[model samples]
Target: MFNDEPGDNETFLYKLERESEVQKLIAHLKRSKKTYVRRRAATMLGNIAEISDPNERRQAVKALVSAIKTDEDDSVRAAAIDALYQRGEDAFDYLVAEIAEMGGSEATERTATTLLTEWLSADHLEFRMVAATALGERGATAAVPDLVRALTDPAPRVRTRAAQACGRLSDPRVVPPLSERLSDGRQQVREAAANALGAIGTDRALAELVPVTQADEEGLRLIAVDELGQFGSVKPVVVLVDALDDDSTTVQRAAMLSLLELLTTASTEELELICGTVVDELARADIQATVPALLDIAADGTRRRYRQTAIWLLSRITGDRYRSEVIDCLLPAIDKPDEETAQLAEAVLPELRSPELEKRLRVYLSRERGSEEARSRAQAVLDEICDGSSGELVTTGVDYTYVDSPADYTNQHSSRD
Candidate 1:
């Protein structure tokens, strides 16, 4: 009783089915040989799969699976497969088994590869899209080669989905093909390829990602910067640091996050190598803008080692600028609970040659509320800078016993003037 138009009469058919026309519709679905009629009928069965009645839904699922397995019309089989996919995982096993059975036939040679390849190339866009997703959800390593081949499909959606599937598979062998898509004309495809390379996370994939960071697109650059952090290598460090100057704030933030991760994760030796390069970057006026971020790491670093490294790096990079520009930022770390942070700050103090160092030290020594250890640490720094004056000040605080306590001399300079 339905018209020739596909899916246009579904609402009408639903009304009729509620009026006891369900059997007639099923008979029409089973007898129809015309591809469009069968396609619409199979689509209608999917509508039934959504029914709240469990028994009715099972019957619809049974019909949809039977249509996929036995239907001779290509469009009809595709429509039935799409219907099952729309039902989500409830019908996932049937789809996988059908594709696998088709893939394995020797004489027919309609193996899963052959079947998925054909579905991905199907004339209808929906078939190609669903087939790509199915391949990904199947999550088989064997699907890698076929998904790689789909990377160049004529439709951008197919290519995009294929790239996404390759990511889910995370196969290193797919890296080259996925890498080529990083420059795909479609932005979605480019993103999918970059993400796939990230998921694979192989040396080859990392190599592929380096070039992606150089891509003219900001989104791609941001993705590459983020992914490169996982490498924990010299190259990613260099690229991420350069990205700190990127015009896009998003890219800059991503670069900062990645650089921080590298800083926190890299071994002392790795930090040494990375720090040398970072210091060189800091020397250039163009790269000086990144100093605030370095200061943040130093002042509030999450790890003791990273905090020490950050302070050390800041010291070297800002040594020339300290008294004039960076000293205000460096001065506070001397009081941190982390002794290394305090010590690193102390080490950089002499280099600054600021008169303020001696003034702050005297204030710290005179304070009755300070840590003896902190005061001791402060006194040692004072001794290194003030030389002979340190012994005269020794009697002012309990932290200094290394030099003779000049009681009369201490009384003269002990209080803050």
Candidate 2:
């Protein structure tokens, strides 16, 4: 058996199949004079609540709950509460009753909230953070006001937990105060605040989140960008697009994912408008840097339209020099069963024309694995670029219309549909 020294709940509870261990620990809880021994005993009892016999588990829980209310040692009391936390909903009522008893009232409407409030005000920061978390786990709306108040606690740890509790409570009234914390002096608190607002999910929450996307701190900006992306509104598209250039690779990758989410249901006109931002970036020679991120989207076959649209957008951004890179990724996609992917690749292939691309197309045409229509479309693009005799590449099975640049995409900016 692993030594039950101090906080080793893992080892003490690891092999509890033997009833002797349970009897010994339960006896320790009853008779041990040392607070640390009794605390670990309480922790082990809670940990075994799942594996112990039904009668034994119930007895252990009852003992732990009693200890939580009466233990003189603060660590013992905290450990009992944490162990009960492991038991989940089974322990909620006992904890609530303990709160009522602690507050000296079962009749008060705010007994749970009141108990937690006192805990949050405790002089010790660790206790304050624990109380903030317990209030969140309780998931009571009445606790929102208290948690919001705790958001500005002098200790950053308390503020961070308070912000998290606000997210779990998901009360709209908490949005205003949580929004203020987006600019909190501490980065962890700011990130937590942004996440809390995202959970609240009110229109106002999204509006408040937009500004944090521009925050100087990369951690806050990353959270704000991720939360803003969930709204899928074009309003934050420009901000998300700007995040594509954030110096942190993590932030840049996050921005690309958000952009993909925004584009998933966007219309042709919306695509034009969103991709139009990339066009402006292209003007500044900034678009080429995103080639790797865009290729990630193109290669992710699970996101079919996203992959197709990414391939199309990449063809526009990369030009002939990246012709081989674009073709290498898209060529395999042409034979995919999803017709949208095949069609999109066929459309993009015309734009990526070069003698090297021509040779690859010829190879694909000769292969028996591709759909005949795909082969025919490949032949058409080959003819347009290789033969230099084209008004436009037309195939019966797929449209190989050359994707024009800004004009084709930008001209539709006025039409939302």
lDDT of each residue in 1-417, candidate 2, tens digit only: 233455554464345423436666767776677777777777776676455477766666677777766778777776776666666657744664555444334445367667777888776564577678778866767777778889999989789989988888888888899989987888889888898898876668888988887788888788877777666446777777777778888888787777766666556767767666644554454655577788887888677766776887777777665767888888777777888787778777767766567656755665554777777777767787756553223333452322225674454553545
Alpha-carbon shift of residue 154 in model 1 (angstroms): 2.1
lDDT of 1 at 250: 82
Candidate 1 worst ten-residue window by lDDT? 395-404
Clashes of each: 3, 0
> How good is model 1 by TM-score?
0.62
* lDDT of model number 1: 0.69
After superposing candidate 1 on the true structure, give the runs of residues whose Cα lies further than 4 Å from its correct spot.
1-124, 130-139, 168-170, 236-238, 267-271, 285-287, 298-309, 319-353, 364-376, 385-417
Best by lDDT: 2
The TM-scores of all predictions, comma-separated, are 0.62, 0.66
Judged by whole-model lDDT over C-alpha atoms, candidate 2 comes out at: 0.72
Q: Write candidate 1's Cα lDDT for 229-295 as tens digits.
A: 7776677766777788888878876776676666667777787786666567556634355666666
As a whole number from 0 to 100, the lDDT of residue 97 in candidate 2 is 51
Best by TM-score: 2
